[model samples]
Target chain A: MSKLSARSEDYLKAILRLQDQKKVVRVKDLAQLLGVRSPTVVGVVSGLKEGGLVDQEHYGYISLTPEGKVVAETLLQNEELLRTFFEEVLNLDSGEATQNACNVEHFITPRCRERLVSFIRFLEICGRGAPKWLDHFRHFSLTGEPPPCDRCGEIFPGDRRGCEKA
Target chain B: MSKLSARSEDYLKAILRLQDQKKVVRVKDLAQLLGVRSPTVVGVVSGLKEGGLVDQEHYGYISLTPEGKVVAETLLQNEELLRTFFEEVLNLDSGEATQNACNVEHFITPRCRERLVSFIRFLEICGRGAPKWLDHFRHFSLTGEPPPCDRCGEIFPGDRRGCEKA
Candidate 1:
């Protein structure tokens, strides 16, 4: 997971994405995808090839090695997972979700990733029915008042005994 | 915002932290806080002094310029905000919360920071009574089944309509 810098990781990701979209990955395609010049792409690609993370054929076509594929796939999956969590759970918009996910994809540890996975799975499954307190959350976010939950009133006294603290 | 690298930003933060904690900051103290050598801290402090972000007395004590204090305070506040959000909202462990906040404090944009603030303030105020869905979330996180919210059954026809999707 820590094998390469974020820039190199992005190169691998762009290669995989371009491969699916265009069916052939070229050095120029990578440069365009990454918004870099051809020479910069050439330089990074050479380093990637030397690291055994990419294979370059005669015509400047770039493909991931098996090791590279695994790394890229892990990174891509992490990005998707983070984006989905940001969108669904955190209620971030599409642009913010994508940007935040990209910013965070390279940094999440395996433990944090698992915890996020658990958190999102819980939200996706539980929130399908849209519980009543979820509405209070919206109301609170908008109006600064939650209007007091009857159930919580019954469940606990003052100071909110059962809920976890920050 | 884009003026300094993350390493440089950390230097500013450590100087501020040391200033408040020690009342006197030294090159060696900065090295300890940043986990770099004294010479490395000296080099960065020189750059920071030239950049008008830090002042070094003849002996060794380091102090922040007014501009530097503003930047450092902002970063420290952002770090605390992120740490609190991770702890309260995400329910992460203390170690994980601190680790993740440190990893992300430098990268969040002003817009994202505002959104995070709003989200956290909502939770802090609204979740005070420990609403029903909060328990359901805990239960679902633990048991993988929400036990079906009765209120949701009446409100939602099939797929949840009111709740925002990720």
Candidate 2:
């Protein structure tokens, strides 16, 4: 995570997307995708090349190095996971999920994501055994009242009950 | 998407997490949870209050307004979905899935997420009825080549060949 900035990750992801579509990507293509100037793309690409994350041929085309592909794949996988989560469990509109996934992907820690995944699996299993799980979730939505405490199994009424032992 | 910065969203999310535990969140607690100075929490709380996203008492205890609760719930739901996709479908390590989910939650589009969710459902169905579908997918692990194009019904060989139609 410390190795790349959000901007650099975007650049790598853009390159990966373009490379998937075509044999190579150009600076202009990256500029268009990133909404940045060609010079900015060039600088980023140069930085990527120096970092051994990308390979460029005569400035005409760009591609990810094997290492770069690994990072890109990691990012892509994360993006897909976020997309699935928003669509399936929360029932948010799809366009909103995509937009949110794009924004949230840069800041998550590995450990937090793992716990979230486990929670999701728990939901999926619950969903499979009882379609009413979603209904139950909806019935007990986290709104004016707080949902049951995950750790203590106590339901707090209204919006602001102080839990001394939470 | 432009309505909130990632940092702001994070604050909202942190607030929501604390709400889940304590029902009522205090500025000092938020500052500690967020690893920021109390002044920073104060500033964000003020902004949230102005935006009608939170209700704060004179003592600095805070809880989300209805609108704020909705936003936080939505964000949390997205995070959960991403976690599911990365952990279950992609078989990523839980930590990686969670980290990825945090980043991916903000970018996923509703349409893409719907397709992904339906696809996951379809895969589950296929897994139950036709083990071959699951087997085939398993055969094409990340280390292996990309699987056959669903449209062309032909296995892609290497990177350059059999991908033109894909």
Candidate 3:
């Protein structure tokens, strides 16, 4: 759960996708999907197998173990949520959203994923009020300012001489 | 632009934040923020200087030139969008969302960023119809099934071999 790298996660997810589409996955197929070499796919597959996330025979097709299936499902859920957020909430194009989600989904932690889900729900329920605080919550974008102090909700001016007391 | 690594972007962002806060950024300070050694910071600083993104003297405090500020701002914007998406939509915890945004923001492309923004807008304006699709989407979460075919939009039976011919 905690040990997968983004690269490894990509491979696992790709395998899962292939499984969904074809019910079987091969090294060459995975390599083609990932735009990587067959050797690279082999290396990653070996790693995944060792991790108990993949099951493979000598030269047969590849598939996810039950645990692998769970991980892949979770990763897919995160990727879709992120893609939807990026595409529906942010007004991004579908292709770009998918690509970005593919990259971002791996690095996200479960806690962060939950928060993102909450934020999306708030947007759904609260509407306009959501963006106002969201704008401030992410105030780092607004002028490259230091985040407002969590305690006082005061904008900490970036160039202050010393606001140690304030 | 495409040449900067996530680590490099993090360095640039740290320098930009420091410059905004202190009006001057020292090598040791950047090293502290990045948890790297001073020599490592010096190397990255030299690269940034070569890239025309930063101004540095032999031993003087470092600062970003105007061009560097633009890049930093761009990175900050992407990070904020990602944070908002994660926190507001996904229910991810704020602190964890922020940290994940920090890690992935640098890697996202402008095209992808635009799509994410658009997608968010779509979700906001799409209204009640949105929740209906949520269950269909959640099917992917429950089962490792490929989404209904892109063309016909019919859920493929588990025994199906491929999308139906048009």
Tell me the tens digit of each residue's lDDT in model 3 across A1-166: 5589889989989999999999889999999999999999999899999999999999989999999999999889899998887775555679888988898887777766765675465444332211332343234332344333332212111222232422
For all candidates, state DockQ relative to the true structure: 0.28, 0.06, 0.10
How do the residues B1-166 of candidate 2 rate in per-residue lDDT, one tens digit apiece? 2387666777898899999999889898899988999999999888888888889988768998999889999888877776786677656688788767776666556655555555455435323322233333334443243334342212111122333542
Write down the TM-score of model 1's second chain.
Answer: 0.82
lDDT of 1 by residue, B92-145 (tens): 788898888888877766766776776677655555543444455556556666
Candidate 1 lDDT at B122 equals 63
Q: What is the TM-score of chain A in candidate 3?
A: 0.73
| lDDT at position B47, candidate 1 | 90
- Across all models, the iRMS values in order are 6.9, 18.3, 17.9
lDDT per prediction? 0.73, 0.65, 0.69
Best by TM-score: 1
Candidate 3 residue spans exceeding 4 A from truth: A118-166, B57-60, B81-94, B107-166
Candidate 2 regions with alpha-carbon error over 4 angstroms: A9-33, A36-166, B126-166
For model 3, how does the per-residue alpha-carbon lDDT over B1-166 read when each residue is reduced to its tens digit? 3488778899988998888888889999999999999999999889889999989989998988899999988888888897876665554568877887898886676876665575455334321222323333344334434334341222111122253431
Better candidate number, 2 or 3, judged by TM-score: 3
